[model samples]
Structure formats: C-alpha cells, structure tokens
Target: MSEQKKAEKIVGVKGMNDILPADAPLWELFENTVHSVLKSYGFQQIRTPIVEPTALFARGLGAVTDIVEKEMYSFTDSMNGDQLTLRPENTAGVVRAALEHNLTYDGPKRLWYVGPMFRHERPQRGRYRQFHQVGAEAVGFTGPDVDAELIMMCQRLWDDLGLSDIRLELNSIGNAEERNKHRVDLIAYFEQHKELLDTDAQRRLHANPLRILDTKNPTMQEMVNAAPKLLDYLGEESRAHFEGVQKILNHNNIPFTINPRLVRGMDYYNRTVFEWVTDQLGSQGTVCGGGRYDPLIEMFGGKPTPACGFAMGVERILELMKASGEQYAPNQCDVYVVHQGEAAQLQSFVLAERLRTAGLDVVLHCASANGGGSFKAQMKRADGSGAAFAVIIGEDEVTANTAVVKHLRAEEGAEQNQVSVEFDAVVDYVVDQIVGHGHDHDHDHDHVHYHP
Candidate 1:
C-alpha cells in the first residue's frame, strides 16, 4: 500500500495560541490579582476598539519602529477605503478613544485594560503575535507623585505575585525641545560612523534618530556609547522633574537603576521611561515596560493631557512562575455533582443550580445508566479536576431526598466521609460547610451581567 499523508488541521495562527484549561487557571489568577490591585490604587477600566485606523499606530507608535514598519497587521477594510489595523499596543488606541469620547475633558481619567494585542513576530515561550496585556494609565496628571505612584503600583503588583528577582531600570528622556536637541546630536554623532551601523539603524537615523541609540548591533552599540547622555540635555524643568521622581522612589524605598540608554520601543513615550526585567527568564527578558506620553493626547485631537502607564505581559509572568517554582494554586470548587439515572440527573441539575446561586463554582456531570464505571474511575476524575469534594447522587440517594458529598482528598484506604443533607437545605448547608458561613446569614443576591 502507498504511504498515506495525514490531513493537516490548523489550530492557532502563527503568533496566536489557545490558552488551554490547564494554563487558563494561571491566567485567571494573574488577571484577577492585577485587577484587584489596580482597583485598590483607584484606577478604573477603559476598553477601546481592537480595530483602529492604521495611521494611529504609525504616528503614535512611530512609522520608523518595527511595530509599524514590520509587525503591524495592516489591511484595507472592504466596507470603507480607510485602512484598518489590529492594535499593536494599547496607548495610542486609548489616547484616540479618550479624544473621541472626550473622556479627559471633565477630569483626570485613571484607566486600565486587560486584552490581547496583535503583532507579527516569532512565537516564543513568552512573546507571541497575539499576546495579552494588563495595563493601567493615569492621564492629565503631570506631577512627580504620579510617576512615583505608578512605579509603586508596579512594585506592589510584582510583590503580590511573589515574583522576586526583578530589577527596575529607570530613565528620563526630557521634554520635547531637550529631546529634540538630543536627537539631533545623536544623529550627527552616528552619521560620522554610518558605515558601522546596521541597515535598520541607518534607516531610523534619518526618520527618528533617537531610535538609533537603541540599536542592539555590536557596532551600533559601540557608536551609541560615544553619544552624549540625556541628563546633560535635560532642560531646567526636565531635570527638576526627573529629580523629583527619583526622590519619591527613594522615599518609597524602591530600588532602581538609571539606564540612560533605556529608550522604549514605542515613539509616544517621553520624559520618564522605565522597564521591569528579570534575569530568571532567558534572553528575551523584559516583563513590563512603559513610560510617560504627554503629547499623545494632543496628537489625537484631545487637550494636551499628560499620561504615564505600564503594561505587563501575562504570558511572561506565567513563564516566570513556572520556572521559579512559585506555587500559584488555582481556585478550585469545593464540590462536584455526578449523577446517574433520569431522576438522579434531574436532582443533580437542581442541586448544581442551587449551589451556583449560593456563590460556588460547581461542575455537574451526567452519568449514563448503561452501567457507570467503578467508584475508582469517578474518584480519579474528581482528583484530576482538583476539586476538594464530589457530590454523587445515585438512584437510592435521589429517592431518599439526599446526596452524598465525598471528600476527594482523603488519604489512601481512609474511609470516605459522605454527608447526607436535606434536598431543600442543600445549598445553604453546603455553603456553610465550604465557606464557614451560617445558612441564615443575609447576603446580597443581585447578579451582574456583563455584555461583551
């Protein structure tokens, strides 16, 4: 017989991925932890469109940068001739949305976002074309306290995640005029050694000279080292602002390094630029990166609002947790219901619904009457699910108006503790056993419905 080729079935796009159930718990933990921390810091959430006008990124992120020139997913919308692109980053879209919605007109807006970002890149352990980010931005605040507060929040987040071994690299790029002077000087300096620069560095030299200083090429790095430092070009106001930020960080006892060559990958960032990196990860090591973007609001047609924020890669954090042996146990339900027979199935559904209404994450499985497996199989499934207990209701239990709650984590050869509770008081009784709350305690029952 001729050799047969297997039919290919695509799962994920090149840079995209499917977050499997095994990994989704970690994602949930990371998202919820960050969201709660941001809320405690008084930051609100804002959601902008995933699809934005192509020019927004080209201008906000810089046309000369790799994001615009190479990584962006740009295409012309068939409905309208306007070119559209999936957002590569959050700041430009956030700024555009703030401008269009007049969000900054009333007062300073503290916003946060948790979503996916699009880019065209090699899919690595932590870097992906379709990656997720959790970010926060405080707009219309121009004080050094705002800068310090943002950094403190980041420190708080890393601490909460139990992620140690992270370093803070801070720098200041100064105001527009001072930065302009620095850019001019950098271009002139690199021009003298143009032949030593890479093609990418050479192209950026004319378009955005400041970017040339960020070149990773060995020859370009040598040239960059000879360039003038930004602190020397910082105008009086810029110098004082930078100092004020440092003093606040010092006051908070947050350790940081002054990386003068720390130019962010985005163009809109100005004044303060910083990155949080950890050596725990491999060569690709940046975990969080962001900075101030004072002119972005004005560029997007809104009032000149000063903004600073940072975004952390969720995948990167998870990878670090995996590597560091930092145990982050997912929140698993206390009980699961496995039922057999028509009557028992109905009883399980009713019991599951009642348990859910009482604020428990419950899973219900319908057992077939064509002879379900031995008790060992059911116990194995419950253990694999990481559930603390399992509620099994067979025909006999259903007829007796009760269900068996078996503790899944009981030691080997130990007697399984199964509790028989009244059907009417199942929800209340189970909630009490699981959460240590009395059945009669009054709690708000209003449910919130979120529309995507």
Candidate 2:
C-alpha cells in the first residue's frame, strides 16, 4: 500500500486578525462614516507604501523610541541589499512622501489615509501586531486653531459613531528647548530616587526620561507622578500655543482634562499633544492619539512646515461600538433570482443582469450538481439572502417568456403577493415594486441580452 500523506496545517500569524464577512458590515459603516466626516472637513485621501527605508523612521521617529528601537520589522532587501522596514506608524511615511513630492511647495494641504500598521508587541483585547489606523494630517498649519480643529474633528467622529465613553486628555510637551530643560530636571529627579525606580524606569532614566512618566507599574506610580512635569517648563511661546488650543476647545464646549503625564511615545511630537482615551477597554485605553509635529517636514529635507494630525485604532473603535451595543446591519438585496432547467437558468442570468443595469442589487442562484435542488430548497436560499423579492423563472415561464415576482418581505397584514411579468418588463416591474417608484421602460422589447 502507498504511504499515507500527512496534511500540513497552516494558520495566520499570531496577533493578526481576519475580518470575516459577518464582521465586514460594521467595518464598512465605520469607514463610510469616517470618509464622510473627512470629506466635510475638506480632507483628501492620500496613500503611501507600506515599506519604507529603515532610516526614514529612525530619523523621523527618533532612534530611541520603542517603535524604532524595539518594535520595527526591519530587514535588508534581497535584491539590492538596502535596509527596509514595514511602517510601524503612517505619519513618518506621509511626511516623507510630502517632502519627496514637495506637496506643500505651493501651499499647505489636508490629507487623510486609512491602512494597516505593524508593531511587534504583546497582543491584547484591542491591540494587535497588524492593526489598522485612520489618520488625518493638516500640513503647513501653524496656529493653535489647527490643533483645536483636529481635536474637534475627533469629537465629531465619536459623536457620529454614538460613542460616549471616550474622553479627551490634553497636554503640551513644549518645544525642544523647553523639553530639554524639563528632561534635565526630570532625569535628576529620577536619579535622586534611583532606588525607587523600576527596571523599566531605570533603563529609560537617561535614554528617554519623559517616557518614564508614562509607566503603568503600580509600584513606580508615585515616583512617576512626582517626576517633573513638562508643563512646568513650557516656554513663553509654547505656553501661549497650548493655552490658545485650550481656549478654542473651551469655546467649542469640548470637555477635556489636562494630563501632565500624557507624554506620547513618538519623538517628533512637540507642543499640543492629546489623546482620546476610554475606560471601556481596560489596559488598552488610548483609542486615538496625535499632536502637532512642527519639525517633521523639515526633518525630512523639506522646507520648514508645521503639521498636526491624529490617528484612531479601527479595531479598538469597533470594539467600543460593539460594547456600546451599536447596530449596523448591511443593506439587503433588492431581488434574488431563483431558476430551474437549462433555458430557465439562462433566462434568469439575463434578467438578473437587466435588473442590475437598472440600479438594483441582484443575486442569481446557480443550479446544484444534482440538476439543482427542489424548488423548496431554492426558495429557502432566496429567503436566506435577505431579499425583498424573489424572481422565479421556471420551465413554463421560460417558454412563455415571462417571470413570477414574489414579494419575500412585506409589512404586517400586507398581502405577500406574486405577479406574472413579461420577460422584457421584469426589470421595470421589480424596480417599481421594490423601490416604490416607476421607471420609463423605453428599451426595445425583443432584445434578451445576457451579461455573462
């Protein structure tokens, strides 16, 4: 006997998720709502490559950042032996593209992007290795108004999504000069209390003293809280910028808390920084975070340009929506075509195309291997399709060049009726019955065109 073959079982990489068809409707709803909101704000969509030169992120995001030092997926290209890294975050690539193309040479531009981002980290309920982010960037904007506007845009999105648990946490890391002074004092403070510092804090004590403030270790909480606050060291210009942002937000009646410890993980951020966090997702609380990155464009070899933007985690936002019991049901089809026999199947295909051409969604059923199932089975499928009407084409109807249109979904006490329609008039009849509108049927009745 021949040796039996062993089947290899393969699965997707850990921390990467597959969005099945059952969950696609909610994702579509979120994307559509975001696109609509962005369009209303005059933000246009921009797409950048997923892989960029390793140097771009190291320089733009700072080599000391956890994203650069620990999480980036970097490798040397086999063909050219050049170093490349899958983008951990999109802001750096967007800035790189803007500078490369001189997008802001003439003037500033508002751009948005939506795609997956990679980061190697411990996966949890709203965190994954391969996650998606929807980011909006306003380039060449210099004032506090743009900062406030970005925050307001996020508020509008949360409102549009009917999400209420998320709240805004605002802060200012000040500019390089102010942060340097604060960093000096902060490191000194941590050094004075070195014995109390945790392993994570000790490692970041000098390399990234600011990040030590964001440690979540319960034992180090008091030490981190007592560490010098960046807000205390804000210079005149920096303080004015931050206050200006606050005034605008206050005027707009957007509630927020000024969090002195909200130092973001990215290095390019300075001045206005904010995060929309929620208690709904424990431990993974930040749903959206961004701030003003004024030096990013110049750092990328372009002329000095100021930009501000924000990105929200799609999976986390969807989780919040689900937890809040938000409903999103996909729109059902207008008609399902049930057919039998060779000629009837061919006619059904033609009729389904005709209905689609008239702007109706059609689902045409193909025959099974056993010469198609009984009519009852076909009807079961038609009902399962969530169609408002079922167009039945049988041998008798095929010979007469006609169809039976049965109303599958009807109001209570309303008659669930079926009517005979001429083959040429089927599209018009379905459209009028399903859409509750009449259309001018001006096409030649003799032509029976098949789309397939």
Candidate 3:
C-alpha cells in the first residue's frame, strides 16, 4: 500500500485520539465521581447536540473570542447550506437549548453535561482536539452563594479525584459599563507603552487591550502590573457583589487568590471567574477552569437568567492522578469462565448470565484454540481484568457437573487451591470468595497479557 493509504488506514487524525480499553477504567472512575458529586448536589444532566447552527456560538460565545476566531471546527452543511460547527464548549449550546426548549419558562435550572468538545489546535499531553469535559451549570441565580456552591462542587470533584496541590484563583470581571470603562483605560495604558508590547499584544492593545494583560510576552507582563485594575473601576453593585462572593468563600473556608488581571476570554462572562490550577502535571497546568456567564442566557435569546458553571478536563485530571500515583483500580469482573471446548463455551455463557443477573460482571473465555496459550496466560488475563477468580472448565469438570475455581494470584509454581462446586453453586461460591475476603490479585505484574 502507498504511504498515504497506509497512514490513512492506521493512524487517527491529528489532534484526535482513540481512548483504548486499557484506559477505560480511569475514565470510568472520573466520570462516576463527577456523576456522584453532581447528583449529591442536585445537578441534572443536559445533553446538547455536538453540531449546532453556526450563529448560536458566533453570537453566544462572542465572535472575537479565540474559540470562535481560531479553534472552532466549523463547516458548511452539505444537506442544508446552514453553517454549522462542532461545539467547542457546552455553555453556549446548553444556553441555546434552554432557550429553544423553553426550559427557563418555569424557573432556574441546575444543569450539567459530560461529553466531547472539538477544537482545532496543536495537540499535546493532556490536550486533544476532541476531548471530554465534565461540566455543570446553574442558570437563573446571581447570588454569591450560588457562585460559592459552584466552587465547592469543583473542590469536591478534586477531592473525589484525590488530586493534591491544587490552587484556586478567583477574579471579578465587573459589570458591563464598568468593564467598558476599564477596557478604554486599558487601551490608553497599553497605547502609551506600545513600544514595549509584543506583536500580539500590540494588535490586542487597540482591539481588546485587557487581553494584553493575559499576554505572556515579558515586556507585556511588566506593563500588565501597571495596567488598569478592574477593582478600581468596579461600580457600586459590582463591588458589593464581589465582596459578597469573598464573604461566602471565606464562610466556607475556601482559600483563593484574587487575580485582578483574570479576564475570561468569553464576552458573556461578568462578575465572577475562577480557575483550578495544579502543579502535578508538567507544563500543562489547568485541570479545571470556568466562570459565571450570567448574561449568556439572555444573550442566547432566553429570558434573562444568571448562570455559573465549570468544566473539568478528564484527560488532564487522569494525567495528574497518574503522575501523583493515584491509582484507579480496574473494573472487577466477578467470574472469568474458561471454556475448554465449544460445548463448554455454551455452558460458560449460561453460567456467566446467571452471575450477571445477580448484579455481577462476568467475562467468558472465547479462545478457540485453547491450548495455544497456557493456563498461566489465562490466569494473567483474568487477573488483569480484575476478575475475582478463574473458573477453569474442561471436559472432565463439565461432565462431572462441577468446575475448578482457582485463585488467580496464587504464588508462582504454587498449587492453586481449586474449589470443586456444582454448576448451580458456582455464582454464590465465587461471590463469597471474592467479596468476602481481602484477596490480592497482584495486578501490578510487569508483563501485561491483554484480554477482553
């Protein structure tokens, strides 16, 4: 085959990845943790379409934002000439759904989403073009307590993940008019120091000078210190709201740093913005980050509703957990029924189903050429699967209406204590053996025998 054809057949597209089954347990752990936390907090799941009308995001996320300007995977639809884009974030689409479905008609809604986001960018460690996010949003509440609750939920998620060394950075972007005044002030400040600004900063200085404060250019960084502060320009209401937020956070004993320069990239955000940064993963810092986009609902043509939300990057969190030696134990399969022949395969299936109905996970041996790989290989696969015990069924055991249940992690060259149990008693016997005792399967073996 030609190189191009070979490449097309073998490799995933750039900036995309196939999450292999080996990593699935980690994803499940994080996903389940998020669901548990959200459920305890009374957040309902709201799924939005992956592709949406281009105008929805263009208007809601702001046209000049980086997500709209550079990162969006936008294309014209072949069926309907309507321009469409794969969602880069959930908020805009969620807000659009709330408007179209008239969800805001009744009252405030606490909503969340967990799914993929598409962004065309240089893929790196813990970052992918198509990545998963677990996010929550509270619509129609402007109180600081709502903000504090969101922050607390984020902390809860981090705690559940067992992530350490995380820092909370909070900021207020102020109300619209105050923010407008600060924008003009920033433009004037950067214009005076234009000579020191880098090309990007110089360009942003005129267009959106507050973005200059976010620039990483050393010269711009120095200018940022002297740049205008949003706090000084905060209107009376904005100031009081900010103070209320601080008070609530203090009441909850949540530590945070006020970053005056922390302007969210989206135009809809106002009043509060925060980020959860960690030092665990090298270079890639933010594991979770989001802010209150109070004006987004109205901006999307819904009745005015205040909303706050945050999205946790699952891949980033997993990477950090792995780096910190936080192990997510693999999913436990209750029984691994090894079949010696086609007849045994049928018998194993029946036994596996019985275990399944009893609320247990079971994996059956499907190897056609059974003797090619040794019992050791079978045991390794069973152990790696985190199965409770190995059910070794051969012609002898099947004919006798019983099977040998071997301890999967018995010491090498040591005799495995096999329990001969009637076929009907197998499920109960295995459950008693696995869950009743602290059995160690020694899953940390260096060699991996991949089995499904």
Q: Pick the candidate with the highest lDDT.
A: 2
lDDT of 2 by residue, 1-452 (tens): 99899889999999999999889889988999999999999999999999999999999989888898899889999999999999999999999888888888888899999999999999889999999999999999999999999999999999999999999999999999999999889988988999988887888888988888888989889878877889999989999999999999999999999999999777889999999999989999999999999988888887888999999999999999999886777546778899888899889988888888776677898766765466888889888888878999999999999999988876566764788999998887776664453222233323423332
Best by TM-score: 2
Q: For model 1, what is the error of residue 84's alpha carbon versus the real structure, in angstroms, after optimal superposition?
A: 0.3
Each candidate: what lDDT?
A: 0.80, 0.88, 0.80
Model 2, which residues run further than 4 Å from truth? 1-6, 368-372, 411-413, 437-452
Sort every candidate by lDDT, greatest first: 2, 1, 3
Cand. 3 TM to true fold: 0.90
TM-score of 2: 0.94
RMSD list, candidates in order:
4.5, 4.0, 5.2
Candidate 1 Cα RMSD after full superposition onto the native fold (Å):
4.5
Give the count of colliding residue pairs in each prediction: 0, 0, 0
TM-score of each: 0.89, 0.94, 0.90
lDDT of 1 by residue, 1-452 (tens): 98899989867677688887778768877888898899999999999889999999988887678898899899998887889999988888887877888887888888999899999988787889999888889999998788888889999988988888889999999887888888788778888888898888877878877777666677567668878888789988888888999999998899999988888667678788888998877766889988888988887776678999888888898887777676756556666777767898888888887777666677776465764455566666666666767888888988899888876666677764667777776666666555552212223323312111
lDDT of 3: 0.80
